[model samples]
Target: MVNANKVETEDEYIHVRFRDPDQFDEIRTPEWAEDPAHSVSEGSEVRMGQEEGSDDWQVESVLIKKNVGEDKAKDQAEEIVEKIES
Candidate 1:
């Protein structure tokens, strides 16, 4: 889940909910994601991964679908979360 309000602050960062099978974690928007034109909203589904031997996960892309509804975006996020947890 993304915290909608947090993105509006001066920091221009959003809070993302992350799960690691047995636990839930929180991640903030990275510097690469600070561009207003490409910034992700509360329901956006983003792809994230870390480089080999690196501990930090970086946002790779934000998935966008034409005419998709907010509910659908949320569903997508949930599905990704489920896969990660599984």
Candidate 2:
């Protein structure tokens, strides 16, 4: 609920911490929002929030075309990470 944006990543994801992580315990990750299969992705859903403790959230998963090249994929992933850190 804080911010939203597009990002690419194979495994790296952005996590948001909350003042009360325990309150979000009842929440659950959607079927489509499950973790990635360790594949490349771009413009994938940049999710935020955790299901339980720390009220944290993370990049649900990234999606990229199968034929996409490595450089572009890597750049996209890096951009997502940079946005998270910055």
Candidate 3:
């Protein structure tokens, strides 16, 4: 996921494109999966849900599997910023 701090409110919903482990390129979004209902902190895992006729995937919940110390969080943030800048 992109760094939460760098994301603006208006650009919260992003279309993601990535390569899978098997070397296949894929895009994982439905047209309606744009209007997310919740925001998550950096390093949190999120669950997305879609209503039958809805156009966006809602944020169902967030899971913080582990707590990162301030130093590590800062490092991660910096790495994210570098990625975005490049």
Candidate 4:
């Protein structure tokens, strides 16, 4: 039930519109709209990591569902880090 569309990109930031009715109702600016590196939820984290031997970095973000346990966000971070490292 989660989806996203890239709206725009700049040298310093990228704008993405996320679709999650369970979390939002309409196409609206996120609470952390000002910072592409900010997450809507405290548990989640958004960041850009430089790729190996490349100047460009990859945009990554993850959110833990409410049904999940409290440490779900940290678990998500670990998974993302593992994927990026591999």
**Global lDDT of each model?**
0.38, 0.40, 0.32, 0.37
TM-score for all models, in order of appearance: 0.31, 0.35, 0.28, 0.29
Q: List all candidate RMSDs to the true structure.
A: 9.6, 9.3, 13.2, 15.4
Global Cα lDDT for candidate 2: 0.40
Taking all chains together, the TM-score of candidate 2 against the true structure is: 0.35
Pitting candidate 1 against candidate 2, the one with the higher lDDT is 2
lDDT of 4 by residue, 1-86 (tens): 22333233333333332322333222222344223223333333344434445554343334434444435444444454344434
Best by lDDT: 2
Write candidate 3's Cα lDDT for 1-86 as tens digits. Answer: 43333221112322111212223222233333222211223433333455555554433322332354344433443343333334
Candidate 4 residue spans exceeding 4 A from truth: 1-54, 58-61
lDDT of 3: 0.32
Which candidate has the highest TM-score of all?
2
Count clashing residue pairs in model 4: 0
Q: Candidate 4: give its CA RMSD in angstroms.
A: 15.4
> Whole-model lDDT, candidate 4?
0.37
Enumerate residue pairs that collide in model 3.
32-55, 32-56, 33-57
What is candidate 2's lDDT per residue for 58-86, written digit by digit as tens? Answer: 54333444345444544544454445535
> What is residue 12's positional error in candidate 4, in angstroms?
26
